[model samples]
Target: MSKKLTIGLFGYGVVGTGLYDVLHKSKTVDATIKKIVVKNKDKKRNISPEHFHYDKNEILNDDEINVVVELIDDADAAYEIVTTALKKGKAVVSANKKLIAEHFEELYELQKKYNVPFLYEAAVCGSIPIIRNLEEYYNNDFLQSIQGIVNGSTNYILTKTFQDNLSFDEALKEAQEKGYAESNPILDTGGFDARSKLQILLAHSFGIKTVPEDVFNVGIQNLGDLEIKYAKEKNLQIKLLAYAQKRNEEEVAALVIPKFVKSTDTFSTVNDVFNGVKVQTAFADKQFFYGRGAGSLPTASAVLSDISALAYDYKYEYKKIENSENLKLTEDFNLKVLFRHPSKDADKFQPYFENIEEYYGNKEQGYFVGDISFKNLKEIFSQNSEEVSFVLIEVLH
Candidate 1:
């Protein structure tokens, strides 16, 4: 260990800057940033050679740099950068879930080929340390269950709905306005982010790789304020959950979707922009990791932890991707149930329909509250030829 460890960063966005600050200021004597690679930008402002660069080639080619840290979010570019760095026999660390989820096996082959580390600690759960937990402890035990409100955006939105009685649109607006969620939110609100984390954890805990699309995934788009109302009445909460379990030692349960949680549960208490993961295992019993799931500093803190550990002991850092088998996603993973039914204590809220004399009902007939099966609902609506024209679906308390 030296006073400083030379490193190269591919992105200068939020996580990149935070990584610079942490490594440069950490109390650790041996860990430090050597050079932060960047694309060509304004040169009028003063910048340190150790602070910036203009090309991916510059970072990849440098011999002084020992560790290649990638914060760039793109999956393809990250693949090229990481593979190239590993080919050159340099350590690589990244926070890209898409890349990790898509190319874990390929990346690890290169890692083991050169005996260099390929680390991705911040790829999941920000600073919660779930990946490491699964890799180290849970793997030893029989991890029967893994269920959590894994996405902060959806969790925050649901929390706001519970507290302020905000509509789906209203809560989503607040999330976007506060920068808690993306404008599209298809990824977070859709539960893809949690699925990525679940894939990585599943690989370690189960000794296999699972594709993003392979794991069962259902987003929060269909769920509305009515379910929130029902959850509240039953002393339950609405949350987007990323879950997996070993059903019979030979079977496994992994899916992402909205769930109604009982008030007595720890998950219901976890609210308002906070994230938590609950793991049920034989030895550890039940453990929960809760915090701000994402942000520059929180994610950076996880990255720095990886950097320090990789710097200290690169020997224990074997590539799991190479040894593990890919858990191919089934074409039809539709189990009868995605998760356990809502607790009996929780309100089973459904939308109600009332016929308000609509001038003989022409084209607008039924409201859609996501609870009903869309296939059946569509069939039912299609048969109404009597100028069907009135549909209204909302929370039926």
Candidate 2:
């Protein structure tokens, strides 16, 4: 019989409760979920357990609990929970991507120092086990590229734009209604959510660290309807990709953007809110992992995997931290365009002028409307100019 590893669940939300239920449901339970800790000082819930505690201090002091399952996803609070757990020599399993991306290096170091495992299988592509696969098998393989529909919200939006002929706005609104997107959907659609996951992916795959801001990211916000329309005609699809690959020797890169994927590719066929991750490992060749990618139970399943692994490592006293840099492999570049918000707005615009002859008659770049609110002809404008592109307008006579 496996030693019963005790767990203290830190969130009573969907994933948290779902994990608790899953623990009970699995007959071959290797770990015992002994207690639950939540931050409802005055509120009541359907949660049972007279052992429940509202105070974090009280919760962390419990000696019986040797593992923590962190589903309370706020970055700041999660740092506290994880740190306290590590300090107490308790292992952790977290589904909070934001917290993990921000605190991974610190957490990894802490885990290494304390000789405890920090498992976060639920953070990126949920239940895929892609991270474990990459860390274990592909470390010695030369990786050419990583392309994926890592975010379900943008996938749903783009898929709608293709299949239902719905506008981006329309699709986004529908997604919002379906609970597929949050009220503040910027994180999902605007590429930050995927970028956060990209950091996690890159850290494990490349043994490198990146801040979310470091990823070369461009959201699907500015994609005009015409491009979406054109891509469909060409039998291609647009997927907001979370990419992390090697750019050069000793240099790694990451990107988050809407990219043109050919229709012939299986990734293009993967539509309507499903997520897929394509791997370009030398030995494995072209392999993909696809699924719901985001949800309560699906995410909980990955968390349970982490719980299982963390429990296994704790029970057997396994060497949980395995560094992958000792192997020989070439890192591939992640090609992409980047975006930066304006430092200065309406008062004084820094103009950016382009030599239109560069693009010539490239309709893919823009069109020659011959109307000049926006540049109809990209002439030899000064390279020092600020605003190169503007909205085209016409005057009524």
Candidate 3:
């Protein structure tokens, strides 16, 4: 018989409340919530006041609480809570991607020093279970690449633009209204959210230690209707893609950028608050995992999966971390780039490409296709930042 797992849950927000409800309903795991920690003690809540506590010690100091499930939004505070719990000899589970990715090495050390389990499955791809699959199923295989539309807010906005013909602002407003995006959705729209997820995946898949700042990421904020129309005319769809591929054993290429994917590709079909991650490997070839990338219940389900695993004394070995021998990351591969800008700046930007062709044009608005190295493309974009309005890299199958 399995032992009953006692939980001290932090942050009674969306995911936290959902986790509480799930634990109450689930019988498969013998777990009980001993206490819940929240910041706003005055916030109105339907749950009983007796179950809520504002102080960290209410959960961290409780000897009966064997597990700490953190569902907070502040990465720095979450890091403090997680490390404190780990030092106190409690198994930890979190859904904070930013915290995990930024402090991975420190957290790993704390887990080892304290001899406790720290699992974070909900941090990436929501309920897709990609972390467990990478940790167990694909651990032995030679993973070639990981490509996906990992952000649902961006996906939903893009879907509205493509299907409803809404402007980017209109689509983003709709996403915010529907609770798909935050009021300050810069992280989602700017590709930082997806970049954080990619960093976590890189550590799990390739044993590389890196941060979002080091990645070559471009968001969909600058995409225009003209670029979308151009892609559709060419039987392609534009998607904000998070991609990581092994260029060689010593180096990996990773980036988050807008790509002109073929209409028939699985990525093009993953639309509207949904996410799909395609894992390419030596043995499995290409395997796709699809599910709701966000929301209270979906994310809660992933957190519970970690809790259930911890109930059985499961912890990530992170074997890839030890096996990797100083593998470097780069974004210098070749790419076919599509650029849209004002005709006045054409002379300045067009010369950077190796081979160039005009796709569509007018006296005011014009677009061109060109072949260039990804490094040079980024440099050109930085140099001519204001002139270029849209850029999309051609997806290589």
Candidate 2: residue 178 Cα off by (Å): 1.5
Per-residue accuracy of model 1 over 58-155 as CA lDDT, tens digit each: 87888988888999867898889999999998888889988888887687567667888887878877878877776666645767677777678888
What is the Å distance of residue 282 in model 2 from its true position? 2.2
Q: How close to the true structure is residue 188 of candidate 3, measured as C-alpha lDDT?
A: 94
lDDT of 3 by residue, 152-250 (tens): 999999999888889999999999999999999999998899998988888888888786677778899887878887876887877889889998878
What TM-score does candidate 2 get on C-alpha atoms?
A: 0.80
The best-first sequence of candidates by TM-score reads: 3, 2, 1
What does candidate 3 score on TM?
0.96
Q: How many backbone clashes does candidate 3 have?
A: 0
User: For model 2, how does the per-residue alpha-carbon lDDT over 121-151 read when each residue is reduced to its tens digit?
Assistant: 7888776777777676676777756767888
Better of 2 and 3 by TM-score: 3
Better of 1 and 2 by TM-score: 2
Q: Which stretches of candidate 2 lie over 4 Å from their true place?
A: 41-52, 314-397
Best by lDDT: 3
Q: What is the lDDT of residue 218 in candidate 3?
A: 83
